[model samples]
Target: MTYHHLTIDELTMIANFRDQGVKAYRATKLLHRSLETVYRVYRFLAAGHTLQEYYQHYRENKAHCGRKAIQLPTDEVTYTKAKVAQGWTPDTIMGGHSAVVCGRFTAFSSGAILICGPCR
Candidate 1:
């Protein structure tokens, strides 16, 4: 089954339901959400946090869940481009051909690194 995030309206309804002393299980039945999903929001509100705060905090957490952007130094990017223009393969560059210019870049495949570089 596909997963979906709850919208702000549903979040507010959950908060309103809890405010009226409605139990989480019953609220879940009405919202078509899992008991745990509704209950998590209930528990957060029960902890004295506002629904807006929960939404803001939820968005912040979701934004952080991904591969961080690759971070190579400017000199390394310049060096890689120059070497590639000179008919050099990425494998040769990664395999110590230009170790003096950039020993920091990792394994390269099809012009892209298998893992992001700048380990330090």
Candidate 2:
């Protein structure tokens, strides 16, 4: 099943139900969510966090939870720039090489290199 982030309304409902001393299972049934989801929401509310605060915290936490970004080494970046300036096509530079710096070439050809702080 596809995962769905809880809506603001759902979070409000969870807070309201918990304030009324309702059980987590009952809140789950009312919201058509899982018991764990209900409990997690309730816990956040019980910790004196506002709905917006909870949402912000969730967003901040999830922002860093994805795959780490790939960074090309400084030497490789210099070499790619020199090659491009020497009239070498991006395809030739990337061909038979394990280095994935071709994306930078495409960006350079499209005049994006100036806008990119690292590439510049």
Question: Could you tell me which residue pairs clash in candidate 2?
Answer: none
Tell me each candidate's TM-score.
0.55, 0.62
Query: Per-prediction RMSD in angstroms?
Result: 6.6, 5.5
Candidate 2, residue 16: Cα displacement in angstroms equals: 4.3
Candidate 2: Cα lDDT at 34: 90
lDDT of 2 by residue, 1-120 (tens): 667778778888888898899999988888899999888888888888788998898788767754443455676667667877888876776663466543644445565432222233
Model 1 agreement with the true structure over 10-64: per-residue lDDT tens digits: 9999999999999998999999999999999999998999999999998888787
TM-score of 2: 0.62
Worst 10 residues of 1 by lDDT: 101-110
Give stretches of model 2 more than 4 Å off.
1-3, 16-23, 29-32, 99-120
* TM-score, cand. 1: 0.55
- Assess the local accuracy of residue 102 in candidate 1 as a C-alpha lDDT between 0 and 100: 28
Give me the overall lDDT of model 1.
Answer: 0.75
